[model samples]
Target: MQALGPWLPDDPALPPVALAVSGGGDSLCLAWLARHWRKNLLAFVVDHGLRAESAQEARLTVQRLADMGVPARLLTLTTLTKGPGVAERARQARYAVLAQACREAGCLDLLLGHQADDQAETLQMRHQAGSGPEGLAGMAWMSALPDVRVVRPLLDVSRQALRNTLRGAGLAWVDDPSNQDMQAGRVRVRHSLREQDEREALWRAGLQAGAARMRRDDSRTMSFARQGTFRPEGWVCLGPVLPEPEDLSVLIRCVGGQIYPPAPAAVRRLQAAGQEATLAGVQLVRWRSGWVLVREAAAMDAYGPAYAGARWDGRFELFLPSSVSRESLQVGPAGFGLDRTVRGGWPARFCATLPALWRHGQRVGIPHLGWWAEEALQGAGFLFQPPVPATGGGVYGWPEARGAWFAAHHI
Candidate 1:
């Protein structure tokens, strides 16, 4: 509870804090601990529906949470099916639903129950996969998502310790059979860490790596603040010289609206190829003085229905007034043939990647450029809301690093 201080808020009048309780021993124990720490808490139990008993387990989890005096909701994923990369698919779906639920519930922080054992396994798996230093850090105590902040309070606690806590309270938890499946990479790593010495060594290594990552992130944040200029049109302007690979990668992720940055080697290659190049859905072009990093127009998302709060291209968000009719309205890229006079001197390539409102195949609005087809469409707006921050997500649990990050990003 003391360690969760930085991640949780003290104000009771604000929105409730959320928890991701999976009915497993680890999450159940987390819920149990959190109930005592705060009065206003919401739990979300996600049902992937990958097994015959998943729905039942979710329901039981909800009931258990209710018994503990914590309100909970069951989120059932219907689109996921068994296939290649099913585990990754399920994980992504789970987070998406969790984030959506948090937004609807007015929750800012979502607590996850990733314990020390899971962290050790992640470190081992990433080591085998040739992951970089950031990957070797395993998981951060706090991570920023597009819709919410993910906080892992039990990252320092062992799995067995959580089960022991539940047992001490005379509580029972669901045991998922999939955890023992040998075909899974994490399961194999878990089995291999049967020796206490090996697990401890890996856990220590992850902690050291996390500390190093925090330092690097601080330097990157400083570099971005001094040398990077972020535009509201979803692009960036760099200083005379390109930033280091780590700082450049952060800029690429922000401009490209990608959840993860390009690999370190790929970023290095881009830096070496000083000429105009495209990597990770972003184009680095030479502009006046320094450089301009913009979204690759060719890789933008297809047209989608335009509503009051529609998000397009994962880089811009749409806002339409209630008086505006959404019928036949779609949001897509503002192509080259559109009126360039209203582009406010921004490059045509940059304007081509801007989100525009279309009606019956005609460009109706390019909000950022202040162009509209009619007076009524003037109320339409597009906000540059990229998937991740320009300075990268801050480190949690480390007060100095987290504070530095928050100050740098103005969060």
Candidate 2:
């Protein structure tokens, strides 16, 4: 294995890492290498619980690490599908759990098992889809992934090297049956990525075009920040930020993609709703002062349930709605700060006194399920109500990056 540097690109210190191990050869190999490099590393194994022996595999993976004198934290979750789109839902859940673990552990860099082959496969798949430049860009080396920074150091490394490393270290991993299932889109893509040279050419062209577009997008995003004209919900009460008359849809897409850019019609409707009420979900809301991207039921905020009809006093349980949103409640005493964490436009001090309020959970909401309402709110440090100024936007109280332009805000 190549020696890891004292730092990841542009980062300082031998920062503690959180490795996302899946008990596969790829991830297990990564865990092995990472632990060898940094004593400060923390291993995080997530069991999707899709297979029968999934939890057992997780235990085994953890045990292997322990034998290496590396202890791991296991996070296992059942894949649930109430409706269609199980795959996407499962991915969202996985990342949500990983991000939470990273946060709790105070680890900054979250490492993944993606290697060059994964990138090639991704590029191949997207190219066939005739994807735009952005889509063809494939996996980024280091980027933000909800509550965490994701680093794919192996993007430059071949999969064979990872496999070889695992074997050399006497590690055995599982071969997921799903990978061989031709019915899977990715498997088909993998097969074709190996066969069609012409397709690979097109994909490479797409990647080049994508890189250019990313540069443009970065520029445009800077412009958007400077323009300071996107709003969805911070404490909401904003009008929609969509364009008028419906045809100029191009103006709605965000360069940063923090929220779903509303269609002109949707934007206008949300604008109307803000006056009389509020709209849920991530949408471009037009604030009277400006615009902000309002987050609704943000996938990153998928924690426990929301606290509805809950109490305070450090010993309470807030129940979540069966159909959940990103919004949550913080239970606490008076005089706590009122920020984005709580529900009402009110602060913690004011909202704490409310016999009937929680805090804002995240940037968005759907009200997941509030099944066991009675047993939950037995105690309360304080329900974190969603943050206020609901007319979404970070309260940096400064101009956008372009506007500020110190070069320190962003690289």
Candidate 3:
């Protein structure tokens, strides 16, 4: 309680919180407790509207919240997708809406009611799939949700214990029938007697072991990464990576964060950037033997003169400097493959939109290629270059303002 005091401010300073009350036993207990401890908490009942009684349940939940003196915000979600995965899609949409609501309500914290049993089920599922500790970090106690933070305070308390608490307080609760249906994925893990004890034990043990290994590994990786960033201490964000069984294959974080060891293949593709290549979502600008991942220009920037690689009307061999060719591309043929079609290099966007200034291998004005790259171009390939209608627009030039020293070449 003492350790958690910093998070719990005095009444006047207490930040409002958005509670995701599903009318489940777990969340009910959490709302009940939070309502008592915090004064300005709001209850948000998100009805996925998947079942026949979902709306009615939402109504009952609103009434219950009102009775408890916590104002309720009702949200309903329309169905998306179909078949078995429909439920998960609904869940995602529900959270998306809830997250937006929390932000709109001027609240940074969103509370959830997941308990220990849910964590156990997750562990069992990962164990069955032969996942290592990386997969078993388990549910986070608190995590970022787009713009909101999801805090699960009832994970340590059991569902049975919560029911006892609710009943002890003369409160009635509605049970979600979907939880008991064998069709739900989580139900199988709970009922699996044959694999239950052993799987549970190994996974539980592995989860702890995995956490320890990650801490150790993270410390070591961070030290080496800091050395790499010694040149520009605060300019770049390079630190230890999150623990994973395999090398980091894909990433979405900004550059200032830790730079995990790129896959051997991605490293090679980056090295062999004779023209342009896409790894993960970033475009690699290859120089003699060095390359840097750059955000491709924005879709609205307009494509400049076509790169020599993209201009090849027929098959042509392009020579590379001796130093640059020394490194073999691990990504092989597929790694270099990006659609150069004028419609847009990446299937996701149009090429005319990508910033044209970066490829010239020249200095750029925008520091982060602001608005230059809406999304990274995909389908970039070395051997394959098909000419399509080109996006004609004003070409990008060196950063006139910074007047920084850069290569003699321009893209």
| Residue-by-residue lDDT tens digits, candidate 2, 312-331 | 22112244454433244443
| Pick by TM-score: 1 or 3, better one | 1
Where is the poorest 10-residue window by lDDT in model 2? 388-397
lDDT of 1 by residue, 70-121 (tens): 8999999999999888899899889878988998888999999988788778
lDDT of each: 0.83, 0.51, 0.48
Sort order, TM-score high to low = 1, 2, 3
Residue 106, candidate 2: how far off, in angstroms? 1.3
Better of 2 and 3 by lDDT: 2
Q: Candidate 3: which stretches are off by over 4 Å?
A: 1-14, 193-210, 213-411
Q: List the candidate 2 regions with Cα displacement exceeding 4 Å.
A: 1-15, 79-84, 196-210, 230-356, 359-411
Model 1 earns a TM-score of: 0.90
* Backbone atom clashes (below 3 Å) for every candidate: 0, 88, 21
Give each model a TM-score.
0.90, 0.59, 0.59
